[model samples]
Target: WVRGTRNGDMRDSPEESPEEQDRDEGSSPSDAKPDVTWLGTPISELGRMPDCGQQLPRLKNVSGQHTVLIRTDLLQNGKVPVPYPAKFTDTWDDVHVKMPWSGMNLFPVINEVMVLEPDAAEHLFGSLLPDMVQLALRASELCTKPIPLLKGGMNHSITMSQEQVASLLANAFFCSFPRRNSRKTEYLNYPDINFFRLFEGASPKKIEKLKTLMCYFKSVTEQRPTGLVTFTRKSLDRPPNWKSSQSQLTKLHITCEGTIEDDGYGMLQVDFANQFVGGGVIGSGLVQEEIRFLINPELIVSRLFTEALGHKECLIITGTQQYSSYTGYAQSYKWGGSHQDSTPRDGWQRKCTEIVAIDALQFRSFLEQFHPARINRELNKAYCGFARPGERSQNLSAVATGNWGCGVFGGDTRLKALLQMLAAAEAGRDVAYFTFGDSQLMTDVHNMHAFLTARNISVGEVYDLLGQYYSSVCKSCLSRRPDVSLYSFIYQQVSSSLAPDASDN
Candidate 1:
């Protein structure tokens, strides 16, 4: 949702596929300006599921003819077409519940990323209390290679918390090193720091946790069986000793997070061979092979089997990885904008430098109950025509006037009740109706059902209504846009609940 303010606009990046890019390249549809596309790649009813869970619903493979909306001004009025082909209807979820309904509200913190380098490494990693350390503890050690977030500034940083650093370290430490004949240390300039650098002058308590974290990394590196994966440098690449390997080769078999079925493995090499004394190569030192892997932390966390702490079946990991670096006062975009074209080229040069992980099981579980059905229904009803309560218009008007802009009621009792209802809802309860602000209107209705049958309350109707309610009829009618207040609330609540607090934000 793009919210317009007196000053500027704020929009969240929803995942769009190649087809969506094509449609966005053209004229937007008159009726359906792009709003939130349905969640996930469309799955058919007969879609495949992971071996562990029930099959999920899928939509038909969309064709290019589908037209989605695009901001003409953002693209200089179509000078450069975004690769978003919005060819399908803005689909709401299929299932839903009535309003005045309350179920559950759970927000989970899943993943985070940060910059760690000589300048900020101490600041970033020093803040943790050992007891709270989760990922980068001994079990998973962090590994590093030169992955620049800035265009030319090699002094940039990529830092994650101890837990993620540990997991990352565990996954990559002791992997094959780049061969001496073809070293790339010039590209890998970030100062190397690890668990040892941390807790150097630690308290006994902090030291204990640090020890535990280090031990975990050590055990994995020493005992875990290593495996091999190929890293290909196209012939035209720049010349470093490593790049000079003319004959095509599968040089390193680094540890990675993949079996056979999943090929999301990443490529990395820890260069310990080249020694610099007075900026020149010292007598050839024994090449130390540090570990690096091409693995998505989200996939790893998703696959882990655990029952303790906040655990959920499906963890929802959502966030953007952008190029950014710190100046004096604030962060400036490292790359001007999302480097859609340059990402593939530069991504290969950049390596995973740090990890910031979180436990999102509770949040994921809460989100599961709503799904597309709940969101479609609630969002639909919030806008559709209201069913007049039994009370007179004056009474209803009084309630509306009273609650206008009033923060959600339900107080402490309501919060407790909502939490209880969420638990019951998980067991499949009929309490969704009570969750809506306009409970009297959206009686037990599926979101798609409302979309199909509710003559007075289409999804568009709700958007218009919200635009009308939040900003007033005159402004909405004039601009045909909802105010920032409406969508910001939705995004703020959703994002913080889904992932960890982004320091970059």
Candidate 2:
């Protein structure tokens, strides 16, 4: 979400499309705004579960207070969102539990965008509501299970049962998470936990999103996986000295086809992230990050406590299994169907998939990125995410990335690619660049990589070259000249730097 204090607007860069955002989406009669001003009314018959009188300090941290709705014990001690009570374990499980009256405390904020079948309630959970309650009883046990609350400028990691994640998310489908839905809610900086917004909107796109979510709940409730998922916050106390490193460019495979999720497997996949990790999945903003989260709803749990990323911090998540499939991006987005992720588990019992979430600076004015400080911030961010803790540079996996933050964030793709290249090279990892179906980008980036390789360019040289480009072209271009692309300028500079002098001739 946009962290602007000027207007109190938490606008997010939920890039609706690659090029442009749909200005305003009108709602049909069914798509009218959902008024969730109340949560006492149960949509489904919920079997009561007792809230044992237990007391523990609610989960709290610098990021913000965490409200685990599935824990009824926390709710008993005035943890506000405890709509109803549920006691799964003899203990409160540290997560406030309430047998959700229904599937989700789906918020009203997304009602304008969410549309489902006329009998959406019966469509998915009709007769299954009781079974859902039983499943939530199982899921509620994770309430007090500590999901490492990721704060800024500190390293943290969370590895837990995939079953626990699915359980917590199942509760999210049922809207007991009231605190995160309000403007002044406790998780003011966090994304909304309730799907109520999408449920009320009744729009086709929101309907599609909800459908995908329903599929996840259906899939897990039927058979919960025993795999583990990990979320690690890597904070770089000292970024590499880019000006002195003699690192060489790692291997690169740029393609105009395929995706980072499916094709770029067994590597470090990049999440072109928002300061708020999940972006606008619960809202109208749908793009790379949102789509990824929808397909793997477990990632959405990071919104539970992941504070907005600091400049030097990045969150690395491993073992997230893709659940559903989809076609298209933003407005053209459509859920394909259930995708059973058969990716093997590592020794950690987590999925083999490794995704690094590095939030790029939203270059409000693309030109604002010309400043070296902006470039430095992104380079360090990428390195913080890419650098492995114990693995040597030789063993560090390649990075799968494309036009990160290049959409509505206004990142110059060329500049971003070079910056990432420099970061990856210094980290001693290779790179896999997905052009996202852009042929020209593929050709240009490939050509640039080839030129740099031929020159046997060192990490420091490339670093200096970027600085020179910013100074010689971008810095002056804002007022005096129309600057050429970084590739063109760098090609000229690197070629000239290696050129033969008259004395040599």
Candidate 3:
């Protein structure tokens, strides 16, 4: 089962006129050669690492393996094959993070992090998943709003108010219900203060449209009704048996009878592995890595819309906001790692192989089995547009809502990491680390095989590395905007006696 992609409405039969098709064909003719490009070495074997000028260190536990980490800075050439627009969340530092375990809570309490505990992740992540979904959906909806189409020479693009765009992105990431009287920080309610704000100049029509969209979303789910809950009472409501449950799992489903149109706010249902699958470490040969893949239409919709808005695919990475990064399309080539002469070492190869076997079915089944629960949740919350019991209500006046959206899957950015690593390899760097997910580590290796064949350390080991990677990126992002406050500034901006309807100055 795929862990982190939502199923999408497959009915997009965009009619292409013959003229249009011919025009497109004329622009880029089909080639006889396959589009696939292997950066180095044979597909069957992991290659060796080449020496960079930098010194290399020995890997832990691999007394026999000569491992040296490689680092390089370079972008890949060509349109890397992104099957679908990949979905990824932009870290506060501008690093693209992948979506791993489902449910909306992208920002889990850093202090509360416990690797491999699915149940704990669910409770923490689920608490905010609904809100996150709402924000993503609302943002997408805003994108569909009527905008003043401004033609730029031959290309026509809608004019988006800088504020509107900021609002849309803020809504996508920080859009949340009003802070509860309780001081507990809700992930959904936190918007970044330094994020790009109001544009210097704005058109009246564009501003008006932004207001209308924001107001419309506000009116629909202001109360945060625990709507249409899905997932069987046996599977959802109560927590999962984390101890026996898979080590890493995320679940999602919709709860209601609404069609994709009218109230099809994208998200129908969602859940995740609650336990850490506690166990003692296995002996060297006995360690097992299991990835349960899941895909739901709601998630797909959420990702597609986000991809369009960000102009970046989201599927490749893994983990949560401020917690983990992705490695899918954006970093596929070098995500695993790189070696010299195009060969992947034993460690790098292992990471790449793990990437290939990712299961898409597990996630799909989680939703399929719980379809009834989703319908029931929909029934209970049908009174209001969207609902989530045991959670704060969405503020109708805010530009975003949690329940009205969907989520990206098991926050892993495998593809993006690989691509980045490949670019590094080409640029002649030693010991490069790709922070797309818990994976994406490379040392001195010559070919793809050498890099691909390297033994992967435990996910826990990788997790530690990721924590360091993300922390550095976060620091970099924070450094760029030291003066910006997050939620405090947002509260101040909207709290002025000025109602949203107030005319633009």
Candidate 4:
């Protein structure tokens, strides 16, 4: 389950394609035993639920073919491996999930979290197993309604209750939803939404993540959630005139200490996502996007319906609750306990939190991202994420983001930062950037912002200057110039362009 990755955005590692990775579901073996006493108290028998009561909601605008609500009882085709060409949500097979706890008992898996020993975890899971299954069973009901697949090139949004999100996450925990464990053709485009990958590798970070998820499960099992969340996939049919527009850069607040989740309040938070959205969260890779998905488990539901993001597409998730607090990034990541979310809600009861996921291109070589096409692609993706309804209007909120596609993606931080700022300028949004503990980067970006604002430069100037910089560095594109750092080049060229000329009118 330790797959390869390509980018700093935290995907499966570079060497492996998505198809080559995770061929096996990596679930525990069938021979694994359950604790009869569950370490002390008796494990409760699975309860017989009356017909599920939750009302299934569908998009009023379209026929209901796109959205598949889970009605487990109705899903009893009695097949282990589901029939081909069917989505798990559509089939809702009973054989994969029913009775006698197939594969391994969940006890030892919980022990590794160190938050709860096998005994304690068994007690908690075993006790709540009945109710958890009940929630999983009520998925069609708990959700405000069935969520439509966020297919590429289509603009769509779905609303679900927080209890609905938790219930769906509970389903993910049980791996009850079928056909998600492998990279099969039926669900090849989607990220694996099952918990099987969380148990893979059993690394310390994975353990901590499991603990955090368990905490989320515990809380939701105890209380009813009234808050709601919405997932919106926005696609741009037309983009801005980046090389011609005179739009000026907006306000920038750069910091190195705080993070996007904690520090970025009342702003559009950016998820440096992979094209596959949740990236490697269910697996061993725990980075920015994966960590965010784990902490806000509700976002995991998108994996059930969202397809691979198209180049011009971006995903916006509003009102997702952060169930757990966390420390560190990637492998150093650790799970802190429950976070009580209190953000104000809209009339629809959806939390006010808004997060946009924009996938950055992975550059195999240091110079790859500097290519004009690549630069424009990243800029376009960012612009798509930053652009909102009536986006040209002022009074838009600031975009909270950091160095996207840098680190393992091999993107130059200075270039990425400038591109994001340029994108924000075009979208009419300000930027609140976190340098991810890099004080020098924070200072450099802040100074760069100050220089641009002080000179009152146009967005097209920077955009074209970036193209020139790319052409200068990329010999194949055009004649070469002496290469310098991106910021230094920008400072020199922008100043020279603004300098006095003998032929001035």
The per-prediction tally of clashing pairs is: 61, 36, 188, 7
User: Which residues of candidate 4, in runs, are more than 4 Å off?
Assistant: 1-126, 140-146, 391-395, 476-482, 502-505
Q: lDDT tens digits, residues 1-505, model 4? A: 1122111112222212332232111111123332320111111211100111122343223342222223322222221111111322322232122111222333332223223245665685665655676667665444433355677787876655566567777767776554566777467777767777777674787787787677677777887765656778889889887889899887777655456676665568888788888877777667677778877788888877788899999999987877777654555566766777666554344556778988888876766777778877888899999886553334456777887867566667778888999998888777777665466676688788888888988888888888887776565534333357778988999888878997875
In lDDT terms, how accurate is model 4?
0.64
Error of 3 at 278 (Å): 35
Candidate 2 residues 444-496, lDDT tens each?
Answer: 77778778887889989888887887777777766543458778778888778
Candidate 4 residue 451 Cα shift, in angstroms, is 1.5
Q: Judging by lDDT, tell me the better candidate of 3 and 4.
A: 4
Model 2 stretches astray by more than 4 angstroms: 1-129, 142-144, 479-481
| Global Cα lDDT for candidate 1 | 0.20
TM-score for each of the candidates: 0.20, 0.77, 0.16, 0.76
> What are the lDDT figures for the candidates, one per model?
0.20, 0.64, 0.20, 0.64
On the 0 to 100 scale, the lDDT of residue 198 in model 2 is 65
Local distance difference test, candidate 3? 0.20
Worst 10 residues of 2 by lDDT: 1-10
Per-residue error (Å), model 1, residue 91: 47
| Lowest lDDT 10-residue stretch of candidate 1 | 397-406
Q: What RMSD value applies to candidate 1? A: 27.8
